[model samples]
Target: MAIQKEQIRTALAHVLHPEKKVDIIALNMIQDIIVQDKYVSFTLEMPIKNDPLTQELSQRCERAIHKFIDQDAIVDIQIGINVSQQRQTPAPEPMGSPLSGVQNIIAVASGKGGVGKSTVAVNIAAALARNGAKVGLMDADIYGPSIPTMFDLFERPNVTVQKKLIPLVKYGIKLVSMGFLVDVNQAMVWRGPMVTSAIKQFMNDVEWGELDFMILDMPPGTGDIQLTIVQSVPLSGAVIVSTPQNVALDDVRKGVSMFQKVNVPVLGIIENMAYFSPPDAPDKKYYIFGQEGASRLADELAVPVLGEIPLGQPIRESGDNGKPIVLDNESPAAASFLACSANMQQQLAIRAATMPKDLSISFTEKSPSAHT
Candidate 1:
């Protein structure tokens, strides 16, 4: 049988506070109790920050749960104290920006995988760099990092004198990937907290100085990593990539809605795999996935159709060769990514022009919720 909240609560109730001579339940030190199959997690809420008894009580709770409840129960007790005071702390003076030197942080995201999201991201980064904009591409897809393979970057990022990670430079674009830090052959077996922590380290600890744009190749979906990015960084905007098919467009809608809910502006949509053209004909376009489905959806949403990328062999080969197709001036596929980059730049320009002067980009500081 799966673990129940009440059963775990009953076990935690057995642990008494040594200083207060009362159970944690009576002291109301527990909040946000969660239970799953054999996994249990709860917040060990305390009244003050860094209480000396915090660690002691946490261990006791673990022991009590094992002794009184399921011996095999996996427990994750997180400390969350000083709620009232932390909430009331004044916002620190303009710390510049969370990602200090990066001018624009754009996440290239898709609702589902296999829609060629990363391809679009890498090429977009390359195109932006080709135009002489200082660009950085962060492979935020922790579960299935492809930037290392896509950019042919095999070495780990060097650490600076200040202990910040020095992102490897590739073809003039700075790059970072989870693939570089771990054994490449080993599969990442990580949970939500672990994934979030690793991503936070990528954003906070990397030496990304004075970038014109930081392109984040987000994991396919609106999950923990996406949420953490939106909450942690002041994203200038997001570009939704989708195939020209209803199934992919359906998730694209969800992705759009998720960004809307978080106040991150959806820049526009790039219809990848919008069509396939024969190398021999060079002009014959086949609507294998359906025609302009993403563009129609973009029309419905009143957003711009950035550009349509056709499926091509050279594009794939370029990724395999550790070079973006955009570097090839003759490849038609590269033309598509460059056009998309231009449209994206135009959208960013529009957003900048209409910005409220009083508008603080740090709108996501504590959170959109904290403001409410």
Candidate 2:
């Protein structure tokens, strides 16, 4: 028999929401259900905005449908917030939020940690800023907020008028991170809800003025944290970062699949540490992790390969010094980042020109349930 909507719903009902401690179907969370010939789609309405459990809920739904149907079947799930009618009072606006300043908030993410994802995010923002585009960097990796370190901002963030927090400025880029306010040693113990709350506060309370790009330095892996951040902001698209090694490539597929299931348009893939070139031997390139794993992955997924960043000491030193290699016009690493920025701009232009217009989740405060 072909897969039925009731069959998928029944299976989902068996998988309880881990945090809510209730079956997803019973909680009135599954708002709509539809099944095509070989495609299954549903929307899981969350009770709270940026709910950490929603990410887990998405995976369970995917698993249940895949188990009963074909493993290759297409599953589309969107996480939305259910409107609460009981509350009489309205919620106040959020501060230091990325959606406030940028039209398109793109998260640079990875499947597994330690793939130099933050470095790519920071440099990408720097390259974009240097090109006369206003940019902001939000260090959304709550437990491991590295944007402050990347920008070399040791000073604490201050509150602005309207009682919102102002982002730190460096090399013409505005930035915010938990590293500036919390004790670095204590953040690791934060629970799921605490992390989600912090991300909300960052987005709602921060004063990010006008920006062309607000790059979120997302946490690694397809975990609760990643999902929470995705649900918290209105993202223009997602850029997956990965190395060319086999293990990293395997996890990259999972990361890509997560975005696909959620219907987030993947901008492209950025292969960091693509190769290593000695400072002295600029002409020589060594393939430290093999060749073009990310490019091949892009081919398989039918997304563009944005660019590959070669591994080099200057790239590391520049990041450590709070200066992006892109600022050093003569360096090859700097040139590569500039090229990548141009490629990204071209891709955006192409999308705007060729793609049909549709209503995506809005970043405006009016649509609180929209995905960032």
Name the top lDDT candidate: 1
Which clashing pairs does model 1 show? none
lDDT (CA) for every model shown?
Answer: 0.79, 0.76
lDDT of 1 at 149: 84
Model 1 lDDT tens row, 1-372: 877898888888888878656678755567788888878888776665566877788889988888888889887777765333111111222555437677788889988998888999999999999999999998888889999889888997789897889999989999989898997445367776777777788888888778889898988988766877666656778899998879999989988987766666788999988888998988999989888788789888877889999998888888888899999999989888999999999998776544321211221111111110
Compared with the true structure, what per-residue lDDT tens digits does model 2 show for residues 85-132? 221111222554435446657788999898988988888899999889
Q: How many backbone clashes does candidate 1 have?
A: 0
